[model samples]
Target: MPKSLWKIISRTFFFLLIPIILFAEVSGLSHSMMHKMELLVLQLGVIIFVAKGMSILFEKIKIPGVVGELTAGIIIGPYLLGGIPLPGFEHGFFGTYLALNPGATLPVSPELYGIATIASVLLLFMVGLETNFSLFLRLSATGVIVGIAGVIVSFLLGAWTGMLLLDLPFLHPETLFLGVISTATSVGITGRILTERRKMDTPEGVTILAAAVIDDVLGIVLLAVILGMIPVLNDSGQTVNWGYVLRLGAEAIGVWLLFTILGLVLSKRISNFLKIFKGINVPAIMAFGLALLLAGIFEKAGLAMIIGAYVMGLSLSKTDLNYVIQESLKSLYLFAVPVFFVVSGMMVDLSVFSSRTIIFLGLIYTLGAILAKILGCGIPLLFRKFNLLGALRVGFGMAPRAEVALIIAGIGLSTGLLSRDVFGMVIFMSMLTTVSTPPILDSLFKKEKMGTTEELLPAESVVTEFSLPTLETVEFVSAKSLQLFRDEGFFINQMEMGHKYYHIRKNDIFITMICKPNGIYFESSPDDTHYVKTLMYESFVELNEIINDLKDITKPESLKNDFMEGKDDKRVDLRRVLDPGCIRLNLRGSSKKEIIEELVDILDSQYQITDKKGVFEAVWEREQSFSTGMKNGLAIPHARTDNVGAITLAVGIHRKGVNFESLDGEPSRVFVLLLSPKHKTVPHIQILAHIAAVMSKEDAVRKILDCKTPQAVYQFLTESEG
Candidate 1:
């Protein structure tokens, strides 16, 4: 059978038979006596069409198609103008409408229920699969604390708002359930925003992601507890069964735990099994089967079908099969998910807004949601010294609600704790938050920059020095520093030198040198800084070895004898024997030009003078004329110059800061001078790369500013490397 022909036949069969079946049901045919298999076939077509149309609409609007699909359901159901409202069609096709409406009902049957269940489950599983646990773990402790605070605060606020707005008795069980639904934050929306903004790796992003995960788990538990109290609350404390509630809670937890463990184990096995498919379509089929089975299991366990679907997704997440599953399910999700959302939208009785009670409830709930996050996540950061802006940013980042909101609302409706109006309002809130995030975040980070050159050198008084005397010597340095030198290497020996410098004779060529005076300085260019930093760091290791040798030689006889006699209970403390120093250097010049000129002349007399602009241009031109003015008040003045004989560096600190066109639009206070040999085999660029990495860290920059002496600066740099 050709694919096109099969599709046509499928369509024809569905179109021709659906109306007949519906007419039969409406015309008083008994459900048990009637064979409505044709209606099932027709429904498949309808499901596919709605799914595809909703997906296309969502794509056009840049919203998830799931929203569209749900909207479609609402449109075709009793909630909207398009809903057919055939007597039996009000409920799901297989719902009680058929029995209740008899001859007036549509002929849709329950056979399609399995497919709907499967779709919902698989959608959730994919949510779990997409989550990155490691990224969640990396959020700073402050972020974690803030996230917890947000969840608690938001939940309480939501609960309180529910209590006040709900007209039901103060002690009504449904009110508490409504509160739980209101407090729910959808991880899906937050995840999408983080992904879109490329902030998933940042401190704020990771914290939000982790907090949302924990919040979901906690919310579900709370929902169960609330639901358990419903029967007693509704019956006015009559015939309450605490034991049953406890048993249900325990069972739910056990099932959840068992499922999680099973997912982890099955993920590994599934990954291995997928490998056998090689270039075949077996993986897709296997995934589909697995999705179905998981959904069925979750449904059996009395949890939402999506929970099982999400577990299945998590199981496949660690496997190569995940991408395969995702791709295969894309069409289904695009179609079914939108049906879900559109239906939700259709259910929105806008008339509810006219009710002052509903309006007050919505306002109160929204306020609670905002306040909960601010107080929960933001207040704790004040003690950590984060400014109000930073704390607010963190809180706002966690504010959006998404799919989880709908999930909770659905739970509310199913359990009869909330009316359709309340459920619709909750959905409205979720949509508002979800739609608002992208613009809010874009505005917040529009001026934010990353990986700027200014971040490489943050201090006003810093120096970096580099030396390349011979080819072998350069090779040694390059090997130790891992390609700190990127040009030619030559050996120099028996040359005159001064206290702070050395003169070198490479073959017949000679290079002059000068002693660096206490006030004068020489540092590696930004390019060479990494190499010099690495060499300085390696030198510390050698110093430690020398110290150990001295300690062995100077050991007291009694101590040595005690050790040999096996009477010593403690090991020698090497750290106690070493003396550490701190360094700070501050230099002031009339201008950046005077500073660079004076510092360069002091380093060496023979070194050629290069214009700052020319040097900047040279470095930029090499990498497509890029400026290394990484914002945040730092600039790395680097160039691969031919004027120097070796890979050299000169660091100049500007107390007044220099105009280096930093990305952050701030003055540059630190400069790294880079000199690469005209030709060399060593990768000198690696040194600069490493140094940039070190400087990028906020804490490291702070430590650098705290140094009080040259030796201290050296020690800080060396200790930081470790």
Candidate 2:
């Protein structure tokens, strides 16, 4: 049989067996034992397929693949598409032979339960693995402060809300336990948002992350306390046992501390030990087994299995083996993480929403969740001098409850503190927050520019200062400046008049510029003197040749470099060598073609051209069929072509502007000429974006307009990079 035909036949058989499996499993008779066994195999296979398919679909939509997996469960679960209902054959099946009858009272299959438990534990462990300890350490202090404040505020709000909303007596045990649930911050949701936004390293992001971490710690403690309190609260006539409460607290803390220390120590040794097993073919499986072992230990200690998984992650994080472990776990996470989510969705009772009470609870939960984080976390920022809006933004940023919320809800359900209604409500809240965050953040910071002096400028006392732009800052800079560098190191050195500068020194390259600034006096040691001078001299000569070529073609008297005695006589300042380089050539022509041709002639004459085999092979400009005059009377004409070294840039000032189609459909006044090497121009392109960003600033553009010499333009680009 052809491969395609065989695949079709396999799929057909699988589909056909779905009904057969369902029927045999549902049947309670002895004769259908074989069918029941076959059904089990088929069900597992089908569920896995459905789950993986749904996960892929979710990934395509940019939602977590887990969401899709859960949706898959709903499709195959009893709540939606009914499972097969076998009425007989229970006795004949192996399940019946083993005395494991499939009566209605059998509930869910034990195999399914076991799979779910394993998946849940592994999922939590993966979450632990992803935790960035270095980031946590860097932001530890602020994070702890912010996290604690947020947790306290949210917890208080939740507790208070529960107290006010519940009709039960103030002393009721259930109400208190419910309050504890309300106080929990969904770390999972917050972590996802932090990761997605790439704000995991931001002060605000780090704080939120750290706070969530601490919140989980405290939240678990609170849960234990509340659970313990339940018996006391319910026994109205009995006195509370403070000793037992203290003992439980001590035990919990001792266990947490012991595990944390053990994790820290074990993490140090993990890399070294793993090295010994380097020749082992299944390192991933080994790492996973370790995670399982740790998880089991934590569970045996009466702690949450997820806690153990988290500790395992924390332990491994300190080792070089962390990345390897993370990589190895990717397959499991991809395959099994979705199972947890799907199981979660399968457990959802959709009909619960029809009840007014359930709906009301969900509403209350959502409102409380928002208010809790905002009031809890946001209020403290005011004390730190953040204005109301800033504080609100911070609060709202931390509001969404996700992974942690689900985890907590699961635990609550398993422990019997929360019923299905509460679990469902929490899930609903988690979804609401997760969906609302991106838009909320987008609106809050949409027009907010990054890399302002406040963010980039170093403190006055610091001898050297540097700034790392936020993603928003990078975007703004890219839009406005002609060239930008991200995370590139820059060094500046000043040499005395007679001192020799070398380019070979490891760090002595003078005038080392990365992103925006163009020219400044750079200091280099004698060793690096040659390389630095060569780079600078070559760049300068190349630029000048371009200018001279342009002047030759245009032949405008005003564009000539000759110095006139009175009005035209401008003294050339060598000090301007320390500034960014700029050159402007004026071209006068009757038609656009004449002007462009003259421009091209200048490039061909000026720059030394090298030929290479590739996509962009020669110097040429395209009209782009339209002018790129985006706004503010500026025009950008750019072209990509052959083996050009570095970046060849030219500027033209058309006294009477050309009729290039602007974005506003207006004529352009300024023409900015750009030529990039066909390949390896990504760096040059970044620089061009930086320049555009600079020009987007009205002040910066005006400064460019005031300049007359090539030296002046050089000053702007060089100094800006600084």
Candidate 3:
């Protein structure tokens, strides 16, 4: 232990000892009252200390902090701590003696259960606060399919396991709860591992997370139906009251239906209402209060508290208070969540080890947990054209079971649906799944090297837009081959010396281009399926465009009027626009905005335009919408507006490229800023094309870059073939 931690521990121990000594000396207090106070002190002092300490200890050993918290409760629990005699006290302070007394109900104070309940409620609320409801509707096809498959398979397997072991009837409460536990996985552990491996944003990792989220939603609905019907189990607990069970189930579903309606109807209202307390943290507090209210409503309506909490989160998911609630409620999550885990651990009686049946059932339950997730989640991925390796990775990623298991097992134990031995077995199954899944995932992923997909994205932030355009081969081989793709408006997310990657919006489809000395290579994501045909067609279209462009480059003189618009009788002369005074030689502006201002000034000063501000605003506004920077260090910033009397043009050169947020990753060295009256820039467009074509050539760009003054640049541009 650190010296600071040791000091704090020693002081905490001394202070707790003082409480006992002080309380014992008081003579007026009743025995039970004294015991209550003493126990409260023990819970506050010992429970919190041991829980936090053990969580730290367990975390160091690569086990989850929850495992350590639970182990701490077990060590100090009646099965271990209270099994031994203590000095002075009637029982050991570690636990209330219960198992030692036959036919005795649990002696644990109701206050402790109360705390655990609060922890559960808060934990669920935090989950709700963090969840993104819209994301469910936006999940890719593969994600949706995998999630449903995982749920269907796991739920069936779990129900089968329960029926096989217990001889339960169809739709039995015990059988259904087993299936519920298996269906809802805890993705946090696996998610963190993906983050460590830098694969969190990769196709496989992204699909697993999206699938997990989807299943959690589906699981909540399944669990609600099961819990609602549990009340209809008959006197013998074998047969169910069909009408009553159906009615109860309907009522549960109705509550959720009403919740959805209210959430949709009231989302904007909630956001507007939260704005009332804009300067204060009251919005977050009220958001939490709303979660509690929803939780209470769900509980009263026959669903679990967590279901209500999750619904409340979904309700506020579209609200602006989402991030505020998360940041503010983090302290509450940290303080209260570990208590629920530790208290749950304390509830696990080690006496289950004495029963061979419990051991056997626990092992079988674990087997069902692992195989169901693998077969269930993996098979769908493979069917959806995911590679075998990717299918296996996603399956294991969704396998760890912790949070949902504990919640369901607790519900079962509390409702008398499960016995102590069964509860212990369930908890063991939860721990087993969580502890064993990671190593298998690690081994599987380690053997096949992770792709460069993760490396292309920003590691620390959520990057929405690529900062620059894709870079291509010097021969423009990939550039020409990717022209049709570029026109389709895919985000050029990543680029290297000889490669580029493009992502289709709001979908899992990815395209990668690799340029080789011989030719170019093209491929799309999920290469195991027919999607490759789409990739091939796109590649074919771009190849044709590339061939046509090469043919045009060979016959450059034929392109002078190619990109022109409606013909004008008074078309402005291209050579006149390149006058010495109109060309800015080695312009010194540092940003796109600054360079634009300098170029616009040349046209304004030379032409004496009446509305310089209007012309600048029009040009700047167009640039702001999207970069006018063409590929290979050329930009044609043009605006057609009433602000300018005629089609006017100015050329500016920035040797040190101003990032116009250009498409090409290089600084734009050549600019063609055009300002025209409303409706016509036909001749101007033709001139802009000629400038772009000339800039595209190596010798032409070299001469422009080597220009000594504005006269030299003007001379070169005017003398050059249009």
Candidate 4:
């Protein structure tokens, strides 16, 4: 079928079926008909499926996936499609028991809400783990000022806007909740944009990130105080006890500060404690156990559970175990986090937006939130190192409010402080800021504008960078260095598996290693600068020794015999990649190197290789490590290199035979060269395995060598294999 036709059919099918699914009259499972567990399981499956689908669809159009997840919830919630009757359920799959409690704002069932609550905790914990504590400290002076200013301005403006528009008092819980929501800035969104633009290392970018971290911390503290105050005001019955309220606020702040300080001070000790488990996942699971325990403690102490989770994560952020826990819990994070966002979105009553007054209030609230960040964060920078342009860049970077804002809004609605209409307004403001800020921020960074007039100060840290020939070499060095560090009493954390990024620490020393396509980059404090250099020196020394051993063992006359007898059994069709233009029947070279070069030249002439020299160097280096010569008069010289954009092949037939260091101590007659993109492994291995299988057949090499023309060679290789 044609791709265009298939696409049209798929589109038409979905277009026609969507309405039926949305408004179907089939009976859905009632709480009495099925166990809550069964219903909850089915509901979760639907939520995850729709959430992931919407996320992918939205990402295709250049919007954030989080927005898509939110939309997924709104689409399928009790207020919309979720309210449609379905099979076994009078209410839809995602329907809530809100009919039992007409005042309930949350649309999901208690079990689903319980899961979303845990998801919120995990999400905030990750936020804290990702926060760079060292960078926060280094930029403390400016960051603290900018962050505090932004929070203060945003809070006041949001509260004022709520009061002016909603006719609420300044001290109303709804008004205060609005202020809390405004104080959040999603640096994750901003950081992604900066990294994509290659501006993450810039002064403005760094300042924005640092300030945003501060914003998160202060915002949480404010949330704690507000949460504490709400009870005091309610109990006082419009005659609040000023002294108790002040004391309650003080206690909240004190408890938060005390836990944070204690956590940071004992973080390394806690890391050591968890390491006692030693099991692959035990340590990560135990760490989460600590988070849960602290979350409960925080709730008991009259603060939000997420605040405790964040504090615990912030403390562990400096430990080498940070990445390990992050890596281990990633599956849980992916599964749980989306549920929280979707549930938050489900709480939005689309019915509330029908009122023009509510819509106008939401629009005005969003505008105020935008300008608040600009005036607050941007104005502070003008008095510091930044010019107006730089300040604006930083301000825009701090404007988006995503996960944290949603979390706060959810809390407000759950606590019954925010009505459905007001909650909708908060979500409306958050979505607008998050969706609008990135493009404006990206545009502001179009022309290069320095954040400072004076030359930026030299970094107080040291970086040992190694630009290896290929990503394979970088990985090789990384694995060796990790082992070496572990032996040296340093805990090693692979930042993200297969990403070639690592964080290693021991005692007072900490180091970060990043692997890019071009090189390995290591950053450390000046105090531990020698560790990176020493580690690399040792890795290269080991590499050299390995190379020397390879040179001794893989010589043409010294290699093992009977290699073809142990051929791979897997079969792959060579015709899909085989090209007649890349095959050469006659080759003038008499040496292994020369023969390989001749084959490479053919591929180059066919425009199959992008970087010829790079491909040559890779092939040569790989050959030096271990010869690719088979025992049955065949040589397959291959390299997975960035020099080729795809799977490329070249066939060269050397009639007189070349000394290609064959396994059976015989000269090689048939040379099959393969070069694949470095990032791909499966296809490279499959093709190599397939070639081995093909050649192991009766008289395969003889049949290939018998060809007189390039077309004959190509046809034989492709046809005989199939």
Candidate 5:
């Protein structure tokens, strides 16, 4: 069968299954025991697809993907489209499970919730591993003041708002829960924005991060206290036992601090222990297994599992294994994180909003939440080195609450401390804060220096930077440096594969290397600067030696012939960028320069080239150094210059071959001209490589030479790969 026909039939079958699935749901077939697994599969598919689509739309509008994922869940949740009655599911496909009580907090099934819980644990674990332990300590003084102040103020405002708006007594469980939830902020969200703005190493950025870390710690402790209070407060009407609550909160803090300190202290030993399992995968998996075990222990100890997971990650954050574990678990993170966010959103029951009072409470509560963070976190900065603008930046930075807030609110709803109406209000507040933070933070920091000179401290780590002429040279140096490190008995860890980032350690000596597009950066101790420079000088000397050796044995004519005549197993589609109007069936030019001029004129006539004469000159300059003419009747003339706006192509054929100074001393019949903007030149090399590989086929060249019209030639090229 034809490929096109098969594609159409397959698409038709897929479209036809949609109605079948819907009919099955309507007929109650999906509710059967045998189809339960099928239902879960369908639910996952819809969740992932819709989540990605909504995330893309939100990202286009400059909002975070997390907010979009939440929006996706709300749209498809049981309270809205997911609640429409089907045959057996009177409340729709994703409706609340029958096993739960009427006023249950969760709308999805217990199994899905379980998955989301696991995802949350993993997400927290990843966050912990990525935390900068050294930087946290360096900025802890300011961070502590900002973080504590923010938490206290936010909690008071949130609790007070609940009491005033709901006519509840002070210290009510709902009020306390509200206060606890308000104290939490999303570290991931804040760090992402700072990193995007290139302010992560700045004074305000580091301070915000430090404060965020402390915020998480304090928030978790407060959550533990509230959880302890819930049972006692429920039994006694606002008559709480202060002694037991304080002790419980103290115990929680002690446990957290003890583990955190021990983990940081033994991080090196733990890293060495994990290194027993060779390769990145095993060690990474082993580290994650430890995280899971710790999480379970935390749960057993009557704390959130995420707390244990966070401790384990923080312990490993300072180790050499940190980046390796993060890189290995990336796929798992991508798969699970979205599930957690979407499920959190799914718990939002919009039915509560039918009450005008609930809507009013939500709006008013959201306003209070916003004000609480701004005042709470910002005020502490004024006492330090921050100006009003800096204080505002730090305050806005901490205002956006996300993952931790949801986790706390989930605890409230599950334990029956918070009603569904109040839960919806919490979700409303989280969404608004998260959605509004980025643009506001971005606008405030634009071209403004918010920190005093005395407070803005440089990082302690000594950095050695090198600027290179090209990306290829940087990559070459990086590879050579890795080998040199290995030769010197250093352990090498590739943190990010695509970016060519590496972390190498040998006993007391530790170094980090990163290869950017235009340069390489090295980070090490101050005492190791000389050692680093020595290694770099050695690399340059070795490179120079290699260049000198090549000069003695190189033959330009032989090399050109070998490159052009070489056949490749791979095929690339060149027809997509090749316009039909750019092809010439017959060439009137009989010389090399004339053929190039003819092709340039074709590009100009098609309006693909801006500066036609400049482009022609650029291509000729490249040709003068070495002939583009190959062994066969083929020639590829290309140039990257400012004359072209984008990658453009023009092809011409000469029935009567022209003298193009071919390597094999033969005439040229086929000419392919390529041009690209100098600023955007990466694709230029790729297309040139593709043309050299594809045109090596003698039979393909013969067929192209016989083509009578531009349309036939274009079609043949397009279908050649297929």
Candidate 6:
């Protein structure tokens, strides 16, 4: 699996494989119409096997699988293995099918292009399926800033490179195409690195992910807007007209925004429609159907098909059925998506290297790609208080150019907007950037205190670590950001001024953020800590780039050995208190008292509440003291009494709202009554905090409110928040 070994094995295997394929085809050339379908099948089989082998080979060597597949296309295409002349092959047309159409080049076969189009759409569709729409509802400000900065910087750099190309022999608009390519961040490549390093859920990880997703959205939209000028440029000939181009760009942006927003608005209905097919295996078929339909519609409307496909994926991402659909389409995505990349690499004519100017332009473009991400991605992290190392990690992580970039380059090539040399430049730049990112990123992350926490594990427990800067150092960075007081989106939900734990405000028994000169430490009950650590680590990833940007800590330590240290333990769980056993659906209660009484009776009978009367009196007294309603149709009627031996929950949902003297002056339809010993207030408070967080997503609340069965509500509440 070593890189050198993998390279040798792969190169040797492909060297042998291609010659055999060439020999087979030369010996058996058939232009017969009857065997066309058979030929297509043969082509697909060869591509998939070769692509898969190259993909695995590259993956083992720590390169992205997609990059391998793309390279495979180059190796097998007319440029490399395809160049071999076989006996009688000069009179045959086997090479013609694999090449860019032998006799004629213009107006390439729709059948070939159509297959590529399907592959592209499926790739985007998978991209959409994996997208987390919920991230938008509670986006980290740092991520938004980073995403915006990257898009802007990369776009400018790409455009500048294109302008440079204009000074050479390239067309004016082709520079704009380069700019569009520069605007995107390849989410898959960097995301994979973070995941592999076990840093994907950290603050930097989450921020990078959210920012990457956002940038991708922006990138596609930019591609649409830039591509829209094709018709105008085509009609106006080669003359550069700024005014006309600007008008076309504006129109493209406007149209893209209109359709994108429209798609988002209609997403809920789309999810509902798709929900009917939840148990069926046809979701993949349905997903493809939707993607293709939307792609065609967008194409007809003068935008790119991939844009429509991406939007469709985003729309369906909101549904609970999202993962299921993705699973349904896994095989097709693996087999088909690689072809788009392979075919993209196939178009890179190796003969274009004769032009030194083009090669020099490619170098400039690569610089643009590299600097744009580091400056664009890192600057945001620095401002957000991430130290330089973390910023660099993210910057490098976002450095690679893959699917989206390839798609843009392909568009430019097909539209006749870019010369063959320019296309080669784009591919070369992509290949260089893609191949360079991993080691740089690996070193950056490894340079951080990314060792496992086994050395520091307390007692008979195990811990995990993959981070830079102590937890407190992160808190210090977060505190500085909060002090800036320039909020546009959600910041840390809890940060008591100058305190240890931020958002989970009360010094909870579950998890605590500690301030030590050495660094910030997170503590939890010895019996339970893994889930809490995971939650905190995810929050850190939400912090985005603090390690890369954080500075001026009041009390900071090297924290080389203390990040994420913990014992193997299970933390207190809200699910323990709020499960199906104590849950009621479609309650007939007409009043707050009625609902509470009925819920208490269920807890007393099924939940083993021995002192039922005493517990009821304690809870009812608390309810009378003040309405437990938190408004938005939710009420937490909680009480602490010795009568309750353990913390327990009784939840009821009434279709008809009950008047609970709510602060919002609305009837409450959902009630969660908590009963616990007076000493266990921390767990109660923690559960309340979780409930508050869950309710922040109005859709979560709506789903709970509409659940007709207790099991549905329970499932909705307990599923991983991620």
lDDT of 3 by residue, 569-644 (tens): 2333556555567888767888888888888788878874677788888888878766777655677898777776
What RMSD does model 5 have?
5.1
TM-score of each model, in listed order: 0.52, 0.56, 0.58, 0.86, 0.86, 0.57
lDDT of 2 by residue, 162-281 (tens): 556555554455455455555555556555555555555555665566666677666666665656566664455245677877787787678877987877766656645655665433
List ranges where model 3 is wrong by over 4 Å. 1-38, 82-88, 97-107, 235-238, 241-247, 278-280, 445-722
Which lDDT value does model 2 have at 675? 63
lDDT of 5 at 410: 79
Best-first order by TM-score? 4, 5, 3, 6, 2, 1
Error of 1 at 140 (Å): 8.2
Error of 3 at 127 (Å): 1.6
lDDT of 6 by residue, 1-722 (tens): 67776676667567545544555645655567755655455556666677778888888777778889888877766566654655534422225554446533312234545677789888887887777555443446767888889999998888887776656323346777888789777778877777667676555676777788768877877777666555555433465566876776676667667866877788757756765674556655876798899889878877788878887887776654565567678778887888777777777777787788778888888988999999998877766657777677778878888888888788877777777788889888888888888778877777655222122212332332324454445556445433331231111234333444432211112233444334545444565466545554555665665555565442222321121122212343567776588888767878877888888887877854778788888889878866677657777788877777778777788877888876668888878888778645457666655665555455655788877788887777776343
User: lDDT tens digits, residues 1-722, model 5?
Assistant: 45654565466447535633565545444446556666676667667766766676687678999999988888778878777775555556577363334656677876778878888889889879978877888889989988899889988998899999888877788888888888898887788788778788788888888888888879888888788777777543478889999898888988888888988898889888898998748988898888999889877877888898999999998876776788789888888888878877888887887889888888888888878888988887777877888888888888888888988887787777888788889998889889888788888778566565365776668989989976768988888877888888676777654566788877567798988888899999898889889998898888889889987898788777566655542445566579999999788997788999999999999999888899999999888978899857889988878888888889999988999888778898889998988866356777777777678776767888989899988887776555
lDDT of 5 at 520: 91
Writing each residue's lDDT as its tens digit, candidate 4 over 234-293 gives 632355678977887788888989999999999999999999997778888899889989
Return whichever of 2 and 5 wins on lDDT.
5
For model 1 the TM-score comes to 0.52
Off by over 4 Å in 5: 1-36, 86-91, 96-103, 234-236, 459-463, 483-517, 523-525, 541-577, 584-598, 609-625, 639-648, 653-659, 667-669, 674-722
Flag regions of model 4 displaced more than 4 Å: 1-34, 99-103, 197-203, 231-239, 455-458, 465-471, 495-499, 516-519, 544-560, 568-570, 579-635, 643-671, 696-698, 704-722
State how far residue 342 of model 3 sits from its true place (Å).
Answer: 0.4
Ranking of models by lDDT:
4, 5, 3, 6, 2, 1
